[model samples]
Target: MTRFQSPFVRVCWYLSLAILAVPFVFPFLWMLSGAVKSQTEIFAPTLTLLPETWHWENYAEVFSYQPFARQYFNSLYIACVVTAGTLFISSLAGYALARIRFAGSGLLLLLLISALMMPEEVTIIPNFFLMKWLGLMNTHMPLILLPMFGSQGVMATFLMRQYFTALPPELEEAARMDGLSRFGIFWKVALPLSRPALAAVGIITFLFSWNLFLEPLVFLSDIELFTLPLALSNFTDAYGLPLWHLQMAATSLAVVPILVVYIAAQRQIVESFALSGVKG
Candidate 1:
């Protein structure tokens, strides 16, 4: 319908999509194929796209080893708790940043934005020592608390702030006239309108917490308390080579659900990240 449009332009667009899709789709396809394959076939440079036999037992063995089910539950519940905590705390902080024109608000926002640029690796040493001194090591406390207060949390805060910045201040002022406290305006008025941003923060925070390995490995030592990512890496034999089948199966289990969610909500999910990234 446009004079500038042509068949060649359409071809180029489709080609670009196929190229972009390969890295995402290929890895998952290969992982699925690899997960089903017998041990001998795992490392083939030329991919084994499919195997003659499907070994569903890999999933079972993954659970049979080292209370995998419990580890999974640990990761799931912790992620949920952390996600909810972040949404509340971040939104509270973000709303204040966006709405309140306090004296040091600019400075506070600068510090928070600066934090987003800092890697967790730099603070891990200090955090690890703090956990050890507090006797919180080898527990889920570090896993939940560190991320809830760390860079990921800062990013979520910024996300909510950016969204709140764009909201009409009239609603907040009107609510205040109706006897709504500052907290009530945030919780009842602004937050309800911030579901998209909150959802984004929740999803990203949950995934980051769920897949977090370095913090868990550094802080948690108790086998019962290990998160899924930590548990995934622990699949090893006497020589320390990976137990391919169990690892693949667990990886598949860990990754597949997230991938499904990502695919199902690709638009919202991607938009959330974009909003967060730009704001953060």
Candidate 2:
């Protein structure tokens, strides 16, 4: 029988899903509700989903308190650059590792795989020094370069490599028979068929760069260079006490765009993963 034919089972499955989703869904709901609440209402002894009175001015104050617009732009642009760079570098490396039968190619793939086991915290000190030595501290260069060359990029490369390895050899053989060079086959044939993997990589890389906090915290001190995560932490009074209302408002604004994009492209994201999984 079809799943829909069993009403009791379907109800139980959906009910279980709803129960599991509460923890994840409620926090966002509370954040949205809290954004419009006054400081008094936010920390009130009694909890309510909607505030007693909505304080809309909290959003206006968020922008005035810091170089928020500039910081927002910094994050948006940095994430875009990092995503594009990761896609190009990872796809090229992945394709080569998967398709080319060169000396030490297996060893190179093994080394790259080993990198995934190393945590970012272990490399932070060396990376910081490297950035400073290169005069990249307090600049967007480290932010851009680190994610493109770091563990996240390695993960993307492996993902693409898996996807590429699963592709049928006949396609490349056909292209080769047509007298296409290796680069031409990769550029014109393979890459064109790699849209799903590319989308998966781009989405993941973009989100990683967008939500990156530790790298920005260590490399950047200038407010103008701050990404969203760093900027969100700056919502505080002179006494270093958090301006909770303003912070919530700013966070809501920052989160909404990503939420919108995710909601809109969720189907594509799922499809990409499915395609990658099937191929891999």
Candidate 3:
């Protein structure tokens, strides 16, 4: 049976939620409004939610001002590649850590968790030099390779490990009895049952790779090769001031995929994290 909250309590809960939601919602609303407003209207002394004149053309200008379509594709393809790579590498490593009996597994897991505590900024300088030596600068290679093997990958591996740890060992034993190889059990049984965790990891990795700025800025110098984040910053005047309207329009487009992914899989993400934490 379901229990319903009292009217007064429900009202108070709704009010509180509305208040809490304002900070997060306001920026998106402002960005949408700003995308259709001119510089003069945007900078007007009096704050207004709606533009006096709707410059819907700003969206069209976003493409005209740069190779936005190419940059968009760059971000999209890179994110997809990174997400795919992370899932494969992290799942194999995580399954090993959780299931395989090996010396130094504990130490390796500890070191990985420690690596998560270290911020990417700390390693950016060394990575920049490394990429330069490897001649991967001014290309998308660093953007794809770094995130696939870096902290984001580590986090995904940790999440997968926790989830895999929670599964019953009997399943694998049964598979083994059926003459399934270790990899066969993982590929057929374990992987199929781990959809929630995989979705969570995929969404997180894609967003991380999509919004990545520091890596792209460091590794890529060519505007033609820039990702969305780097390309967003290129929407500037001769004086390097942002052209706000077009920037906002481009940003609005950039955020659409993120919003769609989150909205669609928000429940899965929450459930996956909760399960992993409790099981761990």
Highest TM-score scorer: 3
How many collisions per candidate?
0, 0, 0
How many pairs in model 3 have backbone atoms within 3 A of each other, for residues 3 or more apart or on separate chains, i.e. clashes? 0
Give the per-residue lDDT digits (tens) of candidate 2, residues 1-280.
6776799888999999999999999999898888999987989999899998888988989899999999999999999999999999999999998899999998998999899999999999999999999998999999999999999999899888988898899999999999999999999999999887898888878888999999999999889889999999999888999988888899999987688668877876776556445554
Clash count, predicted structure 2: 0
Determine the backbone clash count of candidate 1: 0
Q: Model 3: runs farther than 4 Å from truth?
A: 1-5
Q: Estimate the TM-score of every prediction.
A: 0.90, 0.94, 0.96
Query: Alpha carbon lDDT of residue 215, candidate 3?
Result: 93
Q: Enumerate residue pairs that collide in model 3.
A: none
What is candidate 1's lDDT per residue for 1-280, written digit by digit as tens? Answer: 6657788799899999999999989977777776777787776566568876788888888888888889999999998999999988999999999998899899998998899888889999999889989999878898889888999889888888989988887998899999998889988999999988887887888788888899888987888888899999888988999988778888988986587667776676787867754432
Whole-structure CA lDDT of model 1 = 0.85
Consecutive 10-residue window with the lowest summed lDDT within model 3? 1-10
> How does candidate 3 fare on TM-score?
0.96
Q: Candidates' lDDT values, in order? A: 0.85, 0.90, 0.91
